[model samples]
Target: MASYDLPRRLVAEAFGTATLVATVVGSGIMATSLTADTGLALLGNTLATGAMLVVLITVLGPVSGAHFNPAVSLVFAMSRSLPKRDFGGYVLAQTVGGVAGTIAAHLMFALPLLEVSTKVRTGGAQWFSEGLATFGLVAVILAGIRFEQKAVPWLVGLYITAAYWFTASTSFANPAVALARSLTDTFSGIRPIDLFGFWLAEISGAVAALLLFTWLLQPGTSSTLSSEAKL
Candidate 1:
């Protein structure tokens, strides 16, 4: 339903992803600089990331569906909302954009250009948290698009804000984001060694959500039921 062509859509995906990650990494850096308390720093990071999602999705949804997350894109493709042919381009754009965002954040704070994160975010609990978080994210998107399309941006923003506190992995449900965060050694970073588990968890969660929600929101059954009731 998007009016933009492939090239424009790719640019929107790249630019939106870049800004989203920049907001995330930049805000985390600023939060750490200003606070000694981890709670307060996390609060700042959460608010900024949530706010950016609202803005980005609102502005770019029409052009590219505002899929800054590879998991989200994959789910869309699976649902046929996004063409399978375009899935690879979306993932590539999101990945490169996320990395660029991290670079931008580091340069803004005068930090090293690229530092492999040493933040060890491994273990079963963390991996499970990421899976659950990503599951909720995709579920929200599917339900919101079906029922409250206009409110999708706000729904996502609010969900992530809460997920940050509830999830152990801080809800880095996006594989592109997780990979980019590995380049930063700040409050939001995750070690590169821990990335595989995150990617697996997120993709699994997304696919599960897609299948479940598709069944729940069965388009054919709904209309058929309505017609039978009318008769």
Candidate 2:
């Protein structure tokens, strides 16, 4: 990978993450505090997240790939698309942005941190949801890199949107994101107790995506890949 401007990448990562977090927190608060139906709140929040994600990726991708989620970074790191030394910076910037986003969400609602709980899935459902969510997210990301390099933002947004509506866990496929989202106990909050289960499932799904992506991208490996591998 060519040298990435650390400052530029950091700024991009921070801003991208911040944008993501802000949307989650802001939308979550709205859903929790205002919406009468829990389902509506979830739908509204995720839809906003999906919209914001697409826009941010389009805007920041040119600068930092708009990897708002660490899993995207991890997959790229595995593929040697990102420098190892920069991973820490990327993660840190993302975390800061997440915190900032959560904080922004809190501030927008004028609520305490304790009130930022997100009411995420738990138990067997949480585990399975994490797996499916991660699988879907990683699949989209890897596919984008391997084939549809041009329409990544739109495709990703569509995937997330559909995942939120179709999947049981509402498709939070990111580990750092899961952790960051957990800090609050609001519409976006996941119980800290359930964190490990979700993370493990998400990791498993991401690894699966890496393997599938590798198999699909390798030439003459049609036996292991799929036509969906096309961008």
Candidate 3:
């Protein structure tokens, strides 16, 4: 809202997006580098990622409203936390920052990125898995901002960890990360062709939350998350 706040928001978005891509790519590389049995690597990455998400949300959430996902930003606007005019700015920052984050990750690892998912090769249970994973994540976030105000940031991380562990799709919830991960043809890559299917599932999940969160989640204050404000 303030003139100074816009730049701060942009910086937060950049930093947060960078952190996300770095964690995914760095962990993916480290995991791949650690021999055949990558279960431990995956576990470590999962925890680190979850923790980073919490930290990022806590630090940047207040500043940027932490709409790290474009879909999240959209839903937030629909839910009225964000101004409609600012939506385009947020989306632009997110998209550019996300792509920049991916490029940074790729450069950091010195890995080759193949145009992997360009032919619609992904199908079957993968789509469903994406849907479920995304829905679970959005549900967690909405619950936080809607009812559990103080718990929102940290819980975001924990929710991510659980999603990775329980969901078939390893819970790549943020579309920013999804696009960034596509840059690297590694354990994280979903082939350029496969991207559409996963994106469709994720978008569906976000929209579902937008439509249903008001009824499903407990009400919260306009400023603080509680049952005080009547929106």
Please state the error at residue 108 of candidate 3 in Å: 2.7
Q: Compute the lDDT for candidate 1.
A: 0.95
Question: What 10-residue stretch in candidate 2 is worst by lDDT?
Answer: 112-121
lDDT of 1 by residue, 71-155 (tens): 9999989878899999999999999999999999999999998899999999999999999999999999999999999999999
* Model 3 TM: 0.85
After aligning candidate 3 to the native by TM-score, how far in Å is the CA of 17 from where it should be?
1.0
lDDT of 2 by residue, 1-231 (tens): 134577888888988888888897789878877768988898889899999988998888888888877777887788788887888888888888888777777777887753444464687876887788888788887788678887899988889888887777788887777777888877777877777888789878888888887887677956557665773
* Cα TM-score of candidate 2: 0.88
Q: Model 1: which residue pairs collide?
A: none
Give candidate 2 regions above 4 Å deviation: 1-4, 113-120, 221-231
**Candidate 2 or 3, higher TM-score?**
2
Alpha-carbon shift of residue 142 in model 3 (angstroms) = 1.7
Best by TM-score: 1
